[model samples]
Target: MLINLWYVAEWSKTVKDKPVKAKVLGQNLVLFRDLEGNVKCTADVCLHRGGSLSNGWVNKKRDCVVCPYHGWEYNGEGKCTKIPSEGDDFKVPPRFKVDAYPVEERYGMIWVFMGDLDEKDRYPIPPLPEYDDPNFRGLETEFTWQAEASRVVENGIDIAHASFVHPVFGYPDTAEDNYIESIEKHEEWAVSHNVMYPPQLKGGFLGWRKLIRKDKQPTVVHPGWYLNGMTVKIQIDLRKDWKIVMFDANTPVDEHTTRTFAWQFRSFMKSPLFDKGSLKRLSTILHEDAQIVEASQPYYLPETLANEVSVKSDKFMSTFRMARRRCIEELGWQIDLDKRDSYNGKKVLTIPSPGRKEALAEGRGWVFETMPLVAPVKTPTEKKDFEKQVDELTVDQLNSKDNVIG
Candidate 1:
């Protein structure tokens, strides 16, 4: 998993008076709302006796998480304010603190930055304007996949698979007719417009929905991906006025498990009465997708394309891979899972949050070692060559008219 990006920790409503436990990028974290109703997140491991802060309760009087083991109180900034054994007159040392992450609430989800990058250098969270717009009716749902988060993201944006996997969206016979219309690329995100022929909407009351589109009607869809939150957004234009948009934030609970927090918004279905069918169809689509994604080979995304073959239809997905590759190779954010697994239960390592980074800069020692990262590609020549390869992947190679893709 890569660091220095925002990941959804939990639903905003879930974190109330009590502390909640969250796992992201394989590190355990504790989240709780303060007296002001602002959510705060910190490393779950307590500095005192290695206790779990999440297992404790929120001390409302002090606006802190009270460690159940020793009653050590940690505030929003993670400084240990009180130790019951030490008594009220004793002052806790400044160094007695835990790693605290930056947290924010948007679109009803709690997002935490799982790295040490300052606010200026961090990628902004993807905006979902539809979530707040009154013109759209929104429904929220969540799913967990026993697969890599990257795989889940790629599957969400893989338009070609809709034909074979989701009969409600496309037909296997019409898969060949699907084509990408245009693509827009950015350093941290990419968007693509595509055209597909799918069956008409089914199961509306009295078959009224069949009039929305004909069987095998051509539809336009725009799929986009953002590095922050590992988010995938797909907007389908059913017609000029009617549209369906899905925004999914896929979180890597670990290297092997991904939890998807999804929201579906529709322009035509404005009534709450239609929610049952809409949700049922959404559930069905997710189940269909899980069947294929979980069984894919290699388990995780490949470091390079050498072991895999990409067709023209995979060009959009390739952009995501290459963007993630840059973060791993040049930015050096990808975690060294192999090295981490070697430590196993012998050691406790946490992701370096901004607080930890600042403390270390000031010569304050920490109790746990930061998680190891994959070594970045060293040397200016190698960096240039890697950039050239990325350009080729995006321009010359992927843009080729041939059916084969590099």
Candidate 2:
């Protein structure tokens, strides 16, 4: 998993009066709301005796989370405020703190920056204009997939799969008619517009749903991906004034697990009575996707496309891969999974936070070691060579054999 990106740790409603446990990018985290009702996140491990802060409780003042094992009170900023054993007169050292992350509550989710980058350098969170728009009624749900996050994200943006997987989306006979209309790319995100001839909507009260769209109707779809939160957004224009938008934030619970926080919004269905069918259809789509993604070979996404064959239809997904790979190799944001796994049970390693970065700059030491990152390309010549290699890889992808079997 890549570091230095914003990730949805939990639903905002989930973290309230008590500390809640969350895991992202393989590291455990503790989330709680302070006295001011602001959400705060920090490494779950306490410096004293390796106790779990999440297993503890918010103190009486509601300003700090008190460790159950030793009564060490850590405030919202992760500074140790009180040590019961040390008595009132004792002052905790400046180094007595845990890694505290920057937290923002948006779109009903708790977004935490899982790296040490300062505020100015971090990419802004993905936008969801439909969240507060009155024209749309949104339903929120979450799903957990037993697969790597990158694989799950690719599946979400792959428009071609709807023909074979989701019956409500398209039909195999009309698959040839589906084509990408245009693609707009950015440094951290991209959006692709596609036109598809799909079958009619399946479910509705009685036979009224047939009026929405007939069989083989031309549909317009916009699929987008954002690096922040590992998000995927698909907007379907059912008609001029009718639309359905799905925004999903895929969080890497670990190397092999992904948790998706999803929101489905429909412009036509503004009443609560229609929500049941909308949610049921969304659930069906997710299950269909999980069946294929979980069973795919090569558990993690390939670092290169050498082992995979990609046709023109997969170019959008390739953009995501290329951007992620840049972060891994050029920016050195990828965690060294092998090194981390080696110290699995014996050592405690935390993702570096803004607090950790500040402490280190001042020559203060941390109790736990920081997670290891893959080495980045360091020299100017090496960067030029890497870019040339990427260009070659992209060129090689265009020569894919259509008849090749998976």
Candidate 3:
């Protein structure tokens, strides 16, 4: 996993008032929502002791998270507010805080910058405009594959794979003829505008023969790949009234593990039934790809072109490989390929997340120790400042002529 890019940590719905564990770019972190409704991402280990913060809970006012081991409190900004070990009056040093990655919640998934903060904005999570379309219903999906993040990302933008991996919309014969009409390459991403001809659509589960205008409409697809964790595949049908857009955000759990967060949007899927059906179909299709990907040789993507074979149809994948090579060579964002792993008896390369270094640095950081289990004390504050604000909003809502509450 390369640094300086946003990776999906987890789904927003999974994170509640209690802290939850999420691994991205090989670093274990915790996520939770404060009373203000803002999501907070912090190093899982407590700064004082090595207690995992995910095993902790929120404070009385829901202002900060309290550690289970020593009751060290950290706010949404990742600053230690209260250290129970020291008296409440003892002010915690500024440096006595866990590392907090820049995070934002977008399209139902929490994204975090696992690299330098300066580059966070340079590579914001790829946008999914289809999710906001008023005419389209949402089809959300997620899957975990035992594959490297790089391989997971590359396969997402590889059009050739759909022919063989996903037989519903494509065939093996056309997989070799997947010619790239054009490719736009940038420093951080690559866009492939290609053509896909789904041979005579026979009646099946999708029933594309009747849904489409013609027996086989040449679909033009533009797949954009951001080397980090986001990809978008947009298919435009000229004769049809609707379009299909698939968005994916792939996060790395470890060197050989990847968790994918995805969504399928259709201009015609306005009903909830279609939304559910599309999501179900998408799950099956992705698992098919996973089966092929897990058995893939040389788990890690090869940096050198000579290490693997390539063809003209591999234009997009090739560009990603070149850009990935630059990240490994010039950007100093690489992994140690010599670390022995218990899986498969072969060493898998693993990159050191900068987030982990900052978490373990001076001033102490999140705890990594497995201390004795302890329960958190919940002392909900009696109608306080936040409740007062809520009361004011409630009054304003009641006084308003419109029935809608603000």
Candidate 4:
């Protein structure tokens, strides 16, 4: 896994005046908001006694983090500002400091770099689509589950598992052949996987309903990584108003745990009743997927030894692993030499394209230059007109048809 790149630590709203602990790619970090309202990430270990800084409280007056065990206070720059037992005239040791990482806030999330400060800007966070659209309503949710970071990510790109492990949560009824259209790599910082979800059995009650209405849809899954690690961004585009959902899973805890953040963007609804009902339905579906992911045992595996055979649907996963290996090598991260040799035996694996050099150079500050900003289709004019009427409709009229009762 690539280190020193920014990974989403928590939703921006969740980090307030309190301190929280986040682990990025196996590095434990203490995150807190200073009195000035700036977020910071520092090595969780106290310099004096190795006590976890996360166990301490934020001192608003001096804008420092006060270690609970020894009264050692550390500022945002990781320098010790106060040592309670020492006399005012006593000089603090020059080495009395904790390591700090660069942090930034965007898209309602806090992203932290987990490596040397000199390499901070080399890898950037990937840009998101929802940030620019006002009509898009964003709903964010988090899930804490026991799983390895790689396994959790592989699950996100595994289109075939939907029919089996997540059949009820709007996964297509049948597994259809899919292929990797293209893969964009960013050195050790990130990889963008573009997968085409071909027309298949649109399962789920919602699918049946759409079928009754003579609507058919195709989906594309765009998964990306940021901050040189396994944090995953999954964007799904369904053709209707309530069709798109974006999921960002940050493995900020460790190899055995993950903090999954999901965001749903629904186009303006014509009816408040429909909006509320849609939220509930989507939330339930997400929870179902969570349950399955949480239940998988031994979530992390050496990909070289995976018993599963690859098919057309697995192209993205296979390509992702190849890109990940190249990144690990490029960043000089440690690798199991045996596994490297084994993977080399298979000719199907290949390194990421060199074209990624330009994109990776743009890094974290890359702006979106493409359009169809919202889905290409505009809402029906009649539907927009009906929005006000539906808003004013009686409860009886709204509840006359129950989309959830099924």
Q: What is the C-alpha lDDT of each candidate?
A: 0.88, 0.88, 0.67, 0.55
User: Which consecutive 10 residues in model 4 have the weakest lDDT in total?
Assistant: 366-375
Model 2, which residues run further than 4 Å from truth? Answer: 378-406
lDDT of 4 by residue, 1-406 (tens): 4444566777788878777877665556788998778998777767776677888999858478888898888888676888889967768764555566678888788877655435424555666677667766667666676765666676766666755655432236435534345555443323434434434334344655344222223455566554333556666554444345465655546555777765666554434445555566556655665677767655544434244334445544544554444334334433233443454434211111112223335452211111111121222223233222112223343223331000
Give lDDT tens digits, candidate 3, residues 274-330.
566567668887888898888887887765543455545665665566566555555
- What global local distance difference test value does model 2 have? 0.88
- Model 1, position 331, has a per-residue lDDT of 85
Residue 74 displacement in candidate 1 (angstroms): 0.7
- The residue ranges of model 1 lying beyond 4 angstroms of the native Cα positions read 378-406
| Candidate 3 segments exceeding 4 Å error | 119-121, 202-209, 213-216, 230-238, 337-406
Q: Which candidate is the best by lDDT?
A: 2
TM-score of 1: 0.94
Scanning candidate 1 in windows of ten residues, the lowest lDDT window is 383-392
lDDT of 1 by residue, 105-190 (tens): 99999999999999999999999999999999999999999999999999999999999999988989888999888777677788
